[model samples]
Target: MAKNLIQVIIAGGRVVGQAFTRALKQEYEASQRAAQRAGGGNQGRKSAANDTFTGMSLQEAKEILNVSDITDAEAIQKSYDHLFGVNEKSKGGSFYLQSKVVRAKERLDIELQSHSKQKRTDQPPDT
Candidate 1:
């Protein structure tokens, strides 16, 4: 057998006393090598649609409000209301959750405005 081959004992969903130093080290090294090959340029990376709200990222805000359609104000408002309603302090809600809901709504509104303006600017002026 090879030295790399490790014998893990069988158990009922439990990892007994064991050493995985080699595995972890190998994983770390592999990740480092991959990073090096990818040009290590993390400066100009654009965020994904589902990343954060305007401040958090559009994706995060949407998730917070349980909204998937970014351009639909009605849907976003409805989702925000539902969440905010459920988290109202008077209704046994957490201040933190209510605040989060508010922020998400604000972010979505800003995003929509920005998107609308961008579209307007992109269109050719009346000739």
Candidate 2:
């Protein structure tokens, strides 16, 4: 009778252990599927639309810097420096200003490059 009881206890433990493992596996698989669905849910749409950096527009940057135009690299750089200096002194300001400076610089640089490219493209082809 004792041997039979021992056998039953051992079998029950094995069954319970297997059930726990199966439950964990199912949970892991469900999480993986959820993650995959999220990652592949939107392909055609702009990924930046929901991004944190998308909150700040170029127009807002220009207004914040008090510049009528961002075509001048010197002006952009000065504005960036001033903002960064202010950020350094104030603990209350958001670090978003640093990101804005980066975005402003990128926009200006890209515009300059495109302008130069257009000029080169418009020139007469080599003889």
lDDT of each: 0.69, 0.62
Which candidate has the top score in TM-score? 1
lDDT of each residue in 9-83, candidate 2, tens digit only: 999999999999999999877655544543544421222222223444445556666676656768877887787
The deviation in Å at residue 31 for candidate 2 is 32
lDDT, candidate 1, equals 0.69
On residues 71-116, what C-alpha lDDT tens digit does candidate 1 reach at each position? 9999998898899899999999999999989988987787787668
TM-score of model 2 relative to the true fold?
Answer: 0.42
The collision pairs in model 2 are none
- The predictions' CA RMSDs to the true structure, in order, are 11.2, 10.6
Q: Write down the RMSD of candidate 2 (Cα, Å).
A: 10.6
